[model samples]
Target: MHSRSRDLVEHAVTKVPAVTLGFWIIKIACTTLGETGGDWVTMSLNLGYLIGSLIFLAAFLVLVSAQIRARKFQSTLYWATIVATTTLGTTLADFCDRSLGVGYPGGVAIVFALLVASLAIWYRVEGTVSVESVVSARVEWFYWVTILFSQTLGTALGDWVAGEDRGGLGLGYETSAAIFGAGLVIIGLLWLWPRVSRTALFWSAFVLTRPLGATLGDFFDKPIAQGGLEFSRFYASGILVAFIAGCLLLIPQRAARRAARD
Candidate 1:
C-alpha cells in the first residue's frame, strides 16, 4: 500500500523532466540562443538593454505562470519556460553590467547572492532543493526563481571572465569557453562518485553551462576581428532554434522519478 501510494505521489507531483543528456543538449542550445537573441533585440535592433530586458521579462512572467498552472509535465511548456529564463537572464545581466555600470564582477556578485538566497530559502521551507522536490506550486515558484538567478549570474560571470571589455576580464571568449567546458567535465565526473552530492554537481553544471553557452554565442556572433565568426545575431539565433526544435523532436523526456531525486 505504501509503495503504491508513493508511486502515485511521484507520478502526480513531479513536474520537472528527468535529468538526461538530451535535456542538457537542449538547455545549452537554449542558453546560446538566449544570448544571441537577446543581443539581436538589444543591439541589432537598437532597443537597448533596458527595453530588451522588459520585453523578455514579460515573456518570462507569462510563460512561468503557465508552467506553474500546468497539471502535468509538458515538455514543450517546460522547454519554453527554460528559454524564457535564458533570454531574460541575458538582457537583465547586460542591463546591470553595462547600463548600470556595475561591471560584470559586481553584477555576478549580486546575482550569485540572490541565487544562493533563493536556494537557501527553498531548502529551509521545503527541506530539499532537489529538482524532484519541485512537487508543489510553491516549490515550482522557488525552482523557477532560482533558475532565473543562476541564469542571470551565468551571463554576468561569462562577461566578467571572457567578454571584451564593455567591462570584462579580457580572457577572450574561446579561452573562456574552454575553461567552462572543462569545469563541466569535472562536474560530470564528480556526479558519478557516490560520495559527492549530486545536487551540488547538478547546480554547478547548470551554472557552468550558461557561461559555456555565453562564450559560444559570442564566438558565433561577435566580429572576426575580435576572434568571433561575426554571424548575424538573428541568423545565429534561428539556427539555434532549429537545432533545439530538432532535438526536441528526436529526444525523449519525462517527469523526474522519486528514486533518484538528483
Candidate 2:
C-alpha cells in the first residue's frame, strides 16, 4: 500500500473501541435498553412493528454515517450507533416474525442465514472477519451489517425460547435470560482453551449477549401473566440508559490500537 493509503487504514482502525470487559458491560446494557425502547415505541405508543422498525432504521443510518465520518472512536457516538442497530433489530425481527407471519423459528432461521452470509462475504472480500482487521470503510460496513443481522436473529431466538405457546420452548423470561447467560459463560470458558479461536469466540459471545439482554428486557417489561415483572417500558428504558451512562463514565474505553503492520 502507498504511504497515504496505509495511513488511512491506520486511521480507520482507530474508529472502533477496543474489546474489553467494559465494552461488554455497556453492550449488554445497551441491548437491554434497545428492547425496552423498541417496545415503548411499538407496543406502548401503538406504532406497531413496521413503523417502529422504520424509525429506528433511520436513526441507525444517521448514526452509522456519523461514526464512519468520525476521525477516531467516540464512545458516545459508537454506543449510540449500537443502540440504534439493536432497537432497529428488535422491531424488524418482530415484524418479520409476527406481521409477516414467519413465526419465531422462521425469523431466526432467516436472520441467522443472513448473518452467516454477511460474514462469509466479508471474509471472502477482506480475507478476515476479526474485529482487529476492521481498518477500512468497507470492512466497517461489513461489521455493522453483520451486527444488525445478529441482533435481529437474537430477538427472534429470545422470543422463541421465552414463549409458552406456538412452538416455543415454554421457558419464561427469567429462565430464558438465565439460559443465554449460561451460554455466554460457556463461551467465555471456551476462550480460555488454547485451541479455541478468539475471533470465533468473540462473535459467539457477541451473538449470545443480545438474546440474553432481550430476555432480560422482557423480564422487566412483560406482564405478570407472561411471567414478567410488568414494569413500564419507558421506565425500564430510562433506567437502562442511566446504567449505560454510568458505566461509560466509570469505565475507561479506548480505541483499539493498530498493529505495527497495517
Candidate 3:
C-alpha cells in the first residue's frame, strides 16, 4: 500500500501547469498583492518593517509546512502558500531597505545575490532545476526559497527603477513598468522563436514578472506626481486577493486532467 501510494504521489506530481499565460497572470496578481498588502501593514498600519516581516514570515512557515505534508498537489493550498511567500517577501525586502537603511539599490544587490545563490544550490541538489521536479520536499523547499528571494529582489528593483534621480536609473514607476513589460515581450518572442532553450526562457520570464508586478503595484499605490493611482494599498490588496482566489476556484485545473493532457 505504501509503495502504491508513493507511485500515486509521483504521478500526481508530474501533472502541474508548465508556466503558461494563465500561470503568469495569476503570478503577477499574487506579486502585486504582495507589494500593496505588505506596504499596508508596514507603512499604513504603522507596524514597523521588522515586526511585519516577522509576522508574514511566520505565516509563510506555517503554509509551506502544510504544503510539504499534503499527499497531493492541492491547488488552493499551493497558491495560498505562494501568496503568503510573496507577502513575506515584500515585508522582508522593506525591512532590509527601509528599516535597516540599506536603501533600494543595496537591497536589490543583496537579494539578487541571494537569488542567484539559491538557484546554484538548487541546481547542485536537484541535478536539474526544473519546476516539474517540485514533487519532492527538498526540491519544493529550494523552489520556495528561490521564489522568496526573487520576490524580495523584485520589490527592491522596482523601487530602485521607479524613484527619481535618487536611484541610479531614475525612471518613473510607470516607465519602469513599461520597460519591464517590453522586456517580457522580448522574452516571449525569444521563447517562441524555436531556437532558445525553453527552460532558460521560462525562468527569465518568471523572474521578470515579479518586478513587473512590483512596479505596477507601486503605480497603483504611490502619489499622483510619482505617477500612481493613489489607491489605498489595503483596498488594492483586498481586491487582488479576491481576484486570485476566484481565478483559482474557476480555472478548471485538475491534476488528473493535466496529467492526461501532458
Cα lDDT, all candidates? 0.89, 0.88, 0.79
Model 2, 126-198: lDDT tens digits are 8778887766778789989898998888888898999865567888888898899999899888978978877
Ranked by TM-score, top first: 1, 2, 3
Clashing pairs in 1: none
> Mind sharing the TM-score for model 2?
0.94
Number of the top-ranking candidate, with lDDT as the measure = 1
Model 3, 68-115: lDDT tens per residue?
888876878877887888888888877877777877888888899999
TM-score of each: 0.95, 0.94, 0.89
As for candidate 2, its clashing pairs are: none
> Which regions of candidate 2 deviate over 4 angstroms?
1-13, 259-262
| Model 2: residue 78 alpha-carbon error in angstroms | 0.3
The candidate maximizing TM-score is: 1
- Which model, 1 or 3, shows the larger TM-score? 1
Cα deviation in Å at residue 153, candidate 1? Answer: 0.7
Model 2 residue 138 CA deviation in Å? 1.0
